[model samples]
Target chain A: MRVGIVVFPGSNCDRDCARAVAEVSGRPAAWIWHKDRDLGGADLVIVPGGFSYGDYLRCGAIARFSPVMEEVVAFARRGGPVIGICNGFQILTEAGLLPGALMRNVGLKFICQDVHLSVGDTGSPLLGGYRPGQVVRMPVAHADGRFHADAETLSRIEGEGRVAFRYCDAEGRVGGPSNPNGSLAAIAGIVSPGGNVLGMMPHPERAAEAILGGTDGRALFVAALSRAA
Target chain B: MKARVYVTLRQGVLDPQGRAVLHALSSLGFDQVRDARIGKYVELEIADGPRDEAEKAVREMARRLLANPVIEDFRVEIPGEGEAR
Candidate 1:
């Protein structure tokens, strides 16, 4: 399967995402410029991490209006698989491809560290390879990763099983300290109502290789590749 | 026309930055300050137009880009004659 990675002006993780995808799926990922207005027929699209447009105005706010995003939004609406990681997640929410908004971390600090994530929902293709309630370790780096939404919208997504991941301890317990960014309900990831678009603050690409200290993130890409077949 | 947009976190949403600022104030012996919340002030210079039409355009800009309705509320202020503070 061919993967497309969006490269915004300030994007720094596009290469890492491409390398991870190529290693895991054995397919060279294509780079889609933020101003290109084309996805190049990629099977899966990834909006990787980094401070796009220097995170101006708001995280992902400016990038959401980029020329490529119009096509990305259209591609997602057509049921194409799209995965947004870290800053990409913020952009997805800003673009209305996903619910909720990512606000500044409650502590007013930029957090960069490894975090434990529980597979809250396995129904979505993004988490297809994982069993429900499975725990994985991934790295998170951001200053505005606090997810917020109305209570009604939260409950609706919960009832629909759209939550793909949740912050938790290694033992799979959820609570303070483990919820690093103060995200509502400790939501670490979520899928669009269509189940085709997924957004998460953790950098899965940073953990996709065993040599990088973990291979847990490889399963997510593997699942997406399988679905593309 | 010139418009000013004030964006503040919605009521009931936690404002850590605001809290930090409040704590700092208290530490500096400004105990009389009951509470404080931080917000953003954005100024926009737009094409000259009728008062009502300019206000309408500014409101749309706030809703679309200046403020995120999920966690914040925004008010557009276009200074005019005979308007009370």
Candidate 2:
């Protein structure tokens, strides 16, 4: 399966995403420039992490207006599989491909550390490999990783079981000091209502290899790539 | 026309930066300061146009780019236009 990784100006994780995809799927990921309007016939699209457009005017705010994002939005509308990691998650939220917004860390500081995420809904194709309540370790690096939604939206997301992951302890217990960013309800990731789009703050790609200290994130890539096969 | 936009977190949304400022003020012994909220102020220059039209356009700009409706509220003001909207 061909994977397309969007490259925005200042995007530092594009190559990391590519390497992870290549390692997991045995296919070299294509680079889709932000200025380009096509996905280059990719079966899956990834919006990788990084400081896009120097993170000006809010993270992912300007990147969502990129020419390529127009196509990404359309592709997602057609039920294409899309995974947005970190800044990519921010971009997806800004593009309205996903719900809610990511706000500043409650502590008002940039954080970079390993965080345990409890898998919530694995019904989504991208996360089907994970079992509900399973805890996976991944690195989260961002200042605006706090997930926030209006009460109504939060209830709807919960009611629909759209939550994909929540920050948790190694034992899978949720909340408290384990919630690094002070995200509402400890949300670490969420999937679109249709279950085709998955957006998460943790660097799954960064944790996909054993050499990187863990392979918990490989399941997501394997599941996503297997679907295309 | 010159337009100024104010973008702030929605009333219910938490503002960490604002809280930090509040804490800093308290640490500095500013006991009278009760609350602090941080927001962005953007200034724009628009082509001369009808007063109502300019206001409408600026409001649109605020909605589309200057602020995110999911977590922010924005106000537009044209100087000498009486009040902000």
Candidate 3:
């Protein structure tokens, strides 16, 4: 798969995300800058983590108007695969590709640590490697990872099986101990209505390699690649 | 002529920064705070011209750059004589 990572001015995780795709999927992804209006012929587009534009006017607010986003939106509308991780998740929500919004942590502090995530299902490619409610360890770091959606939208997402991952412990239970960011319904990630676009607060690219981190995040990219290919 | 824009998070969405401020106030021994929400507003002075043209440009500014309509909504108010604030 030809993967592409959008690079904003303050996107610190772009390289890591590219490396993750290259190592895990054996695909050398391209880096698309924020100013460019083209996507450079990528099958899967990834909006990587980190504070875009320093999270100045709300996370992803300024970056949404970036020139490349127009093409990204068009690509997504054409049923191409797209993933938004961490602040990328914030960007997806800001761009209206995903529902709900990320609020401040319940503890109101910047949380940067390894977190436990539970695969909710194998419906979407992002979690195709795991069974329902399977536990996986990955790192999460964000001050505004608390997901908030209206009652109607939240129910629609759950009822439609759009929730891809949930926060959980080793035993696969949802709560404060398992969910560090206090996301609504312990949601760690969600897919779009069409299931082609995904937005999550955790950093899957950070743990894609066992040498540098853990291999738990590796399967996610592989799954996307398999489907995209 | 001058134009002002107001931006705010939609209803039913949580405002973490506003909540933090309220928590800080409560911890400072001040209670009775019902709620708090944060928003941004900007005022811009521009050339005098057709009112319709000015409003259209300002609205484009809001949609294209000033606001993210998905999470937050924005409004433009070009103050005029005999106008309500």
Candidate 4:
């Protein structure tokens, strides 16, 4: 399976995502520049983490207007698999590919730490390898990572089972102190209504290997790649 | 002409940064502060035109890129044209 990783001007985690894709699928990922309109015939697209456009005017606001995003949005509209992580997630929301906006953290501080997340709906192929209620570890680094939506939108997504993950304690209990960013409903991740696009705050690419201190994130890559194959 | 745009978090939306500032104010003995909210102010220099036309263009700009309608509400004011509703 071919994977395409989008690299914006200020993106710092593009290489990390490429490495994770290579490790999981045994193939180097194509690097698609933000200014390019082509996707390089990739079967799956990944929008990696980092402060795009130097986080100007909002974390992902400027990056959403990048030329490559036009193609990415088209790809997603055609039901192609798209995974947006961290700033990538922020971009997806800004681009209207996903619902809700990521607001500043409740503490008004940049937090960088490993957080536990309970797997929610695995209906999307990107998360098929996980079981419902399974807890996994991954690292989140951001100043604006709190997921917010109107009451009606929140209910609609929840009713449709679009939530992909929720912050939780090690034992899988959700809410309270375990909610790292104070995201509404403790949401850590969500998928598009078609179940093709996945947007999450945690850095799965940063935790996909045993040597990286955890392997819980490998399942997402493995499942996405295998499903495409 | 110059258009001043104010973008703020909509009512009912959480504003953590604003809350932090509120707490700091209270700690400094400014107990009269009931609530605080933070927002952005952007000034745009557009081509001089009719008052109505300039106001309309600035409002469009605010809707398109200056503010995210989902989370923010924006108000536009032209220096001598009064506030654009």
Candidate 4 chain A, run of 10 with poorest lDDT: A120-129
Q: Give each prediction's root-mean-square deviation over alpha carbons.
A: 1.7, 1.8, 2.7, 1.9
Tens digits of lDDT, candidate 1, A97-126:
999999889899999999999997648877
**Model 2 misplaced stretches (Cα beyond 4 Å):** B81-85
Cα shift from native, residue A27, model 1 (Å) = 1.9
Local accuracy of candidate 4 as per-residue lDDT tens digits, B33-77: 999999999998888889789899889988877898879999998
Better of 1 and 2 by DockQ: 2
Tens digits of per-residue lDDT for model 2 on A1-229?
A: 7899999999998998898989987879999999997899988999999999999999999999999999999999999999999999999999999999999999888999999999996489889889998999989999999999999999998989999999999999998999999999999999999999999999999999999888988998999888755
**TM-score for all models, in order of appearance:** 0.96, 0.97, 0.88, 0.97
> Ranking by DockQ, best first?
2, 1, 4, 3
Q: Score the docking of each candidate (DockQ).
A: 0.73, 0.87, 0.42, 0.72
Give model 2's TM-score versus the native structure.
Answer: 0.97
True contacts kept of each: 0.67, 0.89, 0.39, 0.50
Root-mean-square deviation of Cα positions for candidate 2 versus the true structure, in angstroms: 1.8
Off by over 4 Å in 1: B81-85
TM-score of model 1's chain A, to 2 decimals?
Answer: 0.98
For residues B8-79, write the lDDT of model 1, one tens digit per residue. Answer: 989978888888999999999999987889899999887877989999989998898888887889999998
